[model samples]
Target: MASGTSQAPEDGGVMPSRAPELLSGNPDVTPDAIRATEKKKVEAPYGQWKSDITKEALFRGSRKLLSPRVCSRTGRTFFTEARPDGIYHLVEASQSGATYSCHTVLPEGYSARSRVYEYGGGADDGKGDDGDAGPRVIFCNFSDCTVQILDVDTEKVTCLLAESDTLRYADFAAPPRPGSPWVLAVQEDHASAVPDQVRNYVVVIHTATGEVRRAVEGADFYMYPSFSADGGKIAWVQWDFPDMPWSGVKLYWADWNDEDGAVSNVEWVAGEDGMTVTEPRWGADGFLYFCYEKTNYRQFYRRRPGGDMALLDLKRYEEAEFGSASMFIGSHTYAILSKECIVAVATENGSDKVIAFNPETLQSQDLSLPLSEITYDGLYRLSDTSFIVIGGGDTTPQAFYLVDITDNDDGARDNRKLTNIRWSIDEVLNPEIFSTPQHIHFSAKSGPKREIHGFYWPPHNLEYKGPEGTKPPLIVQSHGGPTGHTGPGLALSMQYWNARGYATFAINYSGSDGHGKTYRELLNGRWGAIDVNDIAESVRHLSSSTSTPPLIDGRRVGIRGGSAGGYSVLQALCQHPALFAGGACYYGISDVKLLLQETHKMESHYVDFLLFTPGMTDADKEQVMRDRSPVHHAGNITAPLLICHGEDDKVVPISQAYTMYDDIRARGGEVKLVKFPGEGHGFRKGGELAQGA
Candidate 1:
């Protein structure tokens, strides 16, 4: 929904309230004879009456998030797990003080003939009951992954727990242990090879008697479950495979025996003390916490049951890195909501900070604001001083922020601001205003001062004070998790090439993500030689700037991106075809050896760690994926490309931009392609490929 805008919506929306009297075809036609016949067929490009600044004035000095639904102090009748075809309604706080609302959680031909998936609150089912008064649900149904149950005081579905065809990952648990309602599920034993060759476990369901009772297979590979407070026992998470869950993982715990309700001794504790733990939970005197990331920097731990896990900011000059641009740290503990207080989230590399902590005197304050973007979901302790904090970021959107924490965390008890979802971008379009980005560091043609994170914007209404100093055509831009990066924000095609004047830039190079882990493993096996020498050393440091000397037009350079920044914009335009003149590629991937033979199945073995051998040898990974393909050097491409695609893309497949558009039009070059239709691999739909994006 952020694809700049294309205009549609006249009185009832999607253009047509007599289009300004049919563009004055003649009501005696004379709004200066219909703007002199639309300025003789359309040629007002010069300042075109100026003033253009609104999308509420570039979002009113925007730090964004002016409200679009978010409310859950847990009382809106607590319980929702993504719009499962009907039955959703949070409506109650709107008056701009906004709270939350949704209505249809199940009830349209009963959600087009039921069979939903991923429902919630089985919360590691052991079936608790201290104060428990009704309301609890769970769902799953890839037609037959079966395990449904619902009962928000009669919302329906009430039974049927396990019917597994070998279920896969499940949840629910962590409260005051009263044999609390359990339902964990996770199954295996049906291998067809691949997906790390198979071996998975965890079962336990009991949702009030659909019993299956026990099955916690081990020796590595349990699958994220989480519970252990009162629901007797059951805490999950395991890792194995080309390691990802951030390279290392583990965290176990099992005990629940309430007679024969299952679970049994199980162990492991905080990721086997080797580090790299992750989510965990437990708190309120029980002790557990989580998030480790070995030493590559992620922090926060606690443990304590038998005792000795500690680490909370163990000081390397008190280092801290919270969340953003995620390659890890999606959760960092702290959601208690209250006893003294706890609402935490703290990432210093992708810049996030919602703070509040206490966890019994660990003390910290901060509560977000000052360029606000706090995204820390889950935490709902209604009183002892309020709390909600659901999450929102990057110009904020996912709303829900009740906050009180015994007041004076300063945002004046941050009362309510949660518009009931469905958002609007005022039909998007006033973008183009960039300017703040300069972080340069250079020096790595292979060496290593290597700090490369870029930005540079400039170019609207062109002029660094022109009179004969006209330079603007740049573009550069490139980012697609070749481990990911390129931050700061506003990207309406870098504001339509900065409002048609051009000059863009982007960078983040050498395996991005706020520089850590040996500069992100220096792009592991050097992804296309460290992003073509970090975009040719950010265009030779802006053509050797000395206080912005080169406002770019180095002979009109250009290059665009998508997916792995369209494989670093077709390997930086076929490895510098005399420094780019035009490039566009949206669904990028001109053959990493046919992307390791047509990808998917979660990157079928991820080109054996991004380049070769998840089973290589198709003539040595198709000549190293056609020597890092750009349609194998589309006859040394003379630039002017464009490409873009979607036609139901399943991630870079419109046959990899129609095989780089029939190999750059059979090598005559100067491509074009375009496509779009129904859209996927993410362009998001509306029409005419949302008006050509």
Candidate 2:
């Protein structure tokens, strides 16, 4: 409790400044000696102490919960559970008078999963009219991408339509009504061509006849196909290659002929400038609502049926983004709550807020809740007063919750109600095991003094503390997506190191999305080089920190990351060969050109934006790719390295991992390789995850 002492957020961090006698500089009386003399509690080195939060404990009593949605007709909620064994089971929750009962809807062999663009989305939905015919649930079968419907009333799942391995469907949208017979969906046709040439189009499924017809087609990619309140018109998001949805996309709308389930007179609406527009939904007020970053941060925007697009004039939106990228299908952050109000997830500085706003006046208020991060497709409309969402917090894991709200846009406010229905993990460990993340701002030294955002977690454990006169080693984590972000919330990956007595810092570098589009574009044309500089500056900023006693030992440092972050780890080690003790890269990229050529259709041209300018010749672009790729510079890495990869990874092939390992080993650099069988992109099994730990 002393003034200059370092108090861990939850754990007793560094020992209080030694007694005054120890402060009295005496060469023979070392600080460690004085600290031992002044010690009043049991001394144990960090990371070596016994702790209850083991690596295996993360998944012991835990389950991986996917998207959750509520049926507007009957308040029936549906969500999916992903098991380590690879089957994604769909669960439906229905009210039994006063309680909700969750039951798995699929048989043992069927998995409700979508593989559109191979990134996978458009999995399941509990959409239907108020008629008692049955609650119709749309499910995409993982094994063969079949589009099936579950009749919850009879617990019978029947084929709405069947698909082959070459055909996948997702991003399903059903008009809100009483007797709509068809739903619109996006279809990915892989049998049509190779990876980049795969055919993507929008299709309409007629429930009565089980007939499928193409409604929109000939675009590189399509997403968010939506119909107006009366089903008279439709809107969808589209974009071409060399531009991802988060980078450049267009919003389009068309008149729908309900009798024939066909869209006509389709025309480009918004996104003329192509600035990251997505999730277009027509509000009850007859206005199309969506999230667009035209103003540099993806903010709330609404469009009249045939009028201009206008940004919501809310205060908070000036600093916060309404939603994230549309990398995968089936994710939506905002929902129309009523004719006067709409609710959306607003993200600012790595945190989330569910906000309610009026389309006419743009009056908005943050709904008070215990949730932290709301996953994609997390928001669903239950009624004008309530909704369902899946979220996790600092001390809580992910769970499904029913949120009820008073009208915030009606010129008044009241407390919001959040009811937990089911939890991914029910047991809460000792509070001492949690290390609250402290949001910190530092500047990248090599850049033009741009501020860098990150979260710093001090080593924390209920029973252990670092020995006197020493600081915890630092682990600088670079997050994936390069376009993605490391949020300010409870993350097992962030806390895993904290439980072991290591200080950790997660960087949301310049290209990260939560900040704003201006910052998000900072990595364009300078991915590898700029991100490396920012990370290096972060190490210096933390090492030479102005705190009473430095929080981390810069001399004993390591860099860790996965995917895009993994690539950063390798680049950081090579850029500052003498700065780190070692590095861990999980399915990280080693060759830039290989990634550009071999990545999925969604990101095939993403590296083009990252590594080259618009006018660069083919030769110049190739030179830059070679220059920025870490494998080309592996000889510069002096520290030991560990690399892990999934043999089935299509995003970044295992071949990339093999190439990096071979190059490092051939260069006489200390490197190790670990491979997981049947795992792709990310490890799912608890044992494999723990082994990497």
Candidate 3:
């Protein structure tokens, strides 16, 4: 490999000397030149050849597995799995002889999905078997957004409520009492002239009578309607406009009437003011346990009947997040085991672990599971010392595991054992081709030397190696949610790049979750600047020859992301054009001001926190928004770019991509735009995903 010289063009732009040579074609073609060209095309670079990890495999191989629930009476674990046919099936798994028998509980053509708030949650929940009613599962039908019940014995599916296009339901819970036919769920009604006028609240559905009645109303959003063990009390969480659940929420509880099926004496329990609360669960001891953020970190608190709330202190682990931001309903962070113990998942430094805390003693016992990270709301305690969780490591995909803590006679650190209940996908791809991520921390660009974190995955392939003395290209990935964290899981999409001779870096830039509140607020009023700088610095850090040999080729660095991450990619390229060779933006936001006006109601006020400053005039705020928008600076992005968007995306519409493509093309820059029909904010169909990959 030869080093290329950087030169300043007469147009006041920096240009590489090797750029012209790579783009120019020789006018005089000789027989030797033609032969050389043929040889170069036929022989591919090491690790760059097509392998078994094709685009189809990348999309179809990994199964969508989430929301694990255990039936206490039958000890059967059930979960939702998205099959290759685009239908989400409810699967039930029973353990036997070093393996598990898994069967689909839902009939053909039935999908357990919810579209409430666009990103649905609490799609399915099961009721334990009673002598009279037998076993049943309640779920939100994706086809009509109506609540449906499935009989475990008869396998008969029946709608609990009449199907209506204006009504959607999620986050369901059935009373623990046997022979109980009433189900509690959050309902969203869209029968209004104005979309923003739609009503959201909690409702009770009588399975036997097929009657749906409002249980709680007057709140903009409601979730997690839980019933106590005795069925005498109920609890839930609610939030209003201009404030997402992550920003603030209110927890409420009231007495339940089994005969009348109504709630009374409703009172605010916790999460008043601007505190964020989530996942309210009733313990066996008749105490209400929920997660709330009073300090900088989210932690668990318990409230006894007629008593004030008390913190469940895990003394050694005081700085971790006990609950995650409520992006969707059914975000379970903790579960009750017995009257004295609680099993919870806590996150620190962008990783998650399962811990058992005794509320009586206020001490935590570390359940040393084999996996490094656990999925959010994956913990379900079946017995006093036994539980099930979905988790994975750097090279492992998310899978279900049965964990037993009853044999913890040795101690807290090394007592528990885990049995793999099921894998998200069969291990068909070669493990040798998978690359493990190294957690890298580098200094922020303009902050007070604060550290920015990212996962760096180097190219790995057993069959091929890069050309001698040459570094592989790098792809910088920005995760969505701007508030969401990218965990160290073996994602097939990231591995696809690694297997194809590319180094990948996933940045958890400022404003990302898992970090403390102070670090998460680093992007407040500086969304584009802070995130873009962090991404650019990450690329520079990997490209510099700090090690014996650089891990990435600086001249071939590119950026890519979806949603908020896509916004970061576009801004990074426009702000630092010379640093990135090219970029790929999927449903990215190019104009902040436009997004603020057109985004969904759930995130309508989100831009106020990311872009607005206090006491700024309307004109001043508009200038700031335009100044940070990538569309306004498209001329600055000289590198080649690829933009993709779903035609039905409501969050960041396709017009954003079209405007960006047109702007870059008008400036004489290379650009391409691809739009998918019938797709929304995220691609779901296998064909669309394969093409995007």
Candidate 4:
């Protein structure tokens, strides 16, 4: 990593004397009611404007609605909802006459969450009709970290797999046979001889006997244990250490023996070292469907039972990705609708949209969706033509919708006929005060000289405006995952700050998804340096030279982010202290070495590919890591810093925060550290979020 500081001038109490440039994500749609000068408005300085949005309102509306699981037999869709009160509920949504309703179906204190890879996903699966027993969902109980089954209708809890201190299971797959006793899942054995050497394999769980038996074993990691329609064969994906799921994986199919639980004759179907294989799904027609990248995009592909794997049709839009860089198990980018058709989440240019494909003919088209602009959390195949998906757009908050394409013609692709039911829209959002984010692309100042992607939200509130000729204070956010993307979605946090007359720019940086694989691979072996330089460039690009009138006050600019993003916040403050006035880091990495030891099993080796260059010796890597570690340079960061960490976080341990705080405070630097108890890598409770905000 280079020790060079930014050449951009420092923020020496110099206020930018021009109005911030307002860029709209939607320029042609509606008249600007937020900036209507004719309306009487409260005049105030930037970053201090007052509006209806408050911390209480911002967090009260925040709910984690994800992991949508649908039961075809019961016509009910299940979703995991994490509320501010700290109870994680398995919410069931079913359609009534003209509307739909969602309510919790899980027992009290029973949360439908997974802890497999430490950053758990793939914790629950719903299918099978158990006669008078009704629909049931099998999930990993977060309380004891065990696998359990819950009867959806009766709300009865049954133990399928016993609790284990060393074993964790996720990405469950149940046989298609009604009332089948067998289901498959990816099981992780954490009781390895070497603590960090967590072993991963597949197992078959006997629902009737409450017994878990090994089915398949070999890979360093396993995911999506999908069974064939007839339950004779199974298909799954596997990857090894040093390669993230998005980097490389292999798909395999095998024979399943009913007499004794075992998977045999496993054969590699697809995937290679450079390619990424997503959730392997078995269509009703017995074809295995998945997404992988051979070129620059993760295109769709499917394999027939005894035929070679072939690419599915993208309908001439092959440049877009049919799948995403899925980080967790049970992540669905596409679902097998039928042998003829499949509905998938296609990401293009940093936006998510649903694209329906004719797999046999290799043709696809954009679905006529009401929330057509942005879709996330993947698609669930409920029936042959109807699938439940979570989608939203620039003006739309993320909501649940049951898309029924059975009645629509191929040409119209209409969305009005689609069933959009009840959502987590408890808060009434006034569109007049919401500041829309406009997509902005700028060049990096150093290292590679490529385009960087981000969104700019100009401060907007119908009731307030900044006085005179001063621009707004900018919050340049570095999103988590570092592999994550920031788009123009309706975010209450962004709006709350905007209502307070604070301009914000969220940069996708170099390694963000939705872009091609080439762009995503840019962070390979140069995580902190590349991402930090991009952050500095984001402030420099928007603060002065690029925008005509300059969209922000360079002197009052700050940075905030969490997880990997928090790491960037620290690096941004340390590497380019002059560019940022302050920084807020939440559960961020302080020392690269600490991260190597403290992070979870799934992301343990991720640092190797992200920051360690190929062929670098262990000693060489350590030297490089120490150079980039924020803990080593805390004494040099003069900017006021706020560090927040969940005490229960297993990913980036709380020790990282405490260590950083002590080092910085020992050097007489301005710093504050706050801990949220009973929280994990990310804050879930409303009060915790509000306090952190």
Which candidate number would show the highest TM-score if scored against the true structure?
4
Candidate models: Cα lDDT each: 0.51, 0.77, 0.77, 0.76
Task: Give the winner by lDDT: 2 or 4.
Answer: 2
After superposing candidate 3, which stretches have Cα over 4 Å from the reference? Answer: 1-51, 127-133, 193-195, 410-415, 430-432, 545-550, 691-693
lDDT of 4 by residue, 1-693 (tens): 111112211111111111111112335445464335535777788877777767866565456667788776766778877677666778777656755656678878688778888777877887465766678888899878778889877889888777888888888887877767888888889887353588988888888887788777767888888888888899888888878888788889999876666788988899999788887778777778788888898887778878988876566668787665566777776777776667887777676677776766666677745453343454788877778787665655666667777535653335423555434434545454678778888777676968888888999876677887888999988889878787677777777788788899888888888888989889888898888888887787788857878989889898999999999999988888888889999899999898888777788888887888879998999898999899998877989999999999988999999999999999999999999989898887886677666
Q: Write the per-residue lDDT of candidate 2 for residues 274-318, one digit (tens) a residue.
A: 487877877778888888877878877888876887878787578
lDDT of 3 at 345: 83
Number of backbone collisions per candidate = 45, 0, 0, 1
Q: Better model by lDDT, 1 or 4?
A: 4
Arrange candidates by lDDT, descending: 2, 3, 4, 1
Model 1 CA lDDT for position 516: 53
Query: What digit string (tens of lDDT, one per residue) describes model 3 on residues 602-655?
Result: 677787778877898999898999999999999999888999899989778788
User: What TM-score would every model get versus the actual structure?
Assistant: 0.30, 0.90, 0.89, 0.92
Comparison by TM-score, 1 against 3, better one: 3
Ranking by TM-score: 4, 2, 3, 1
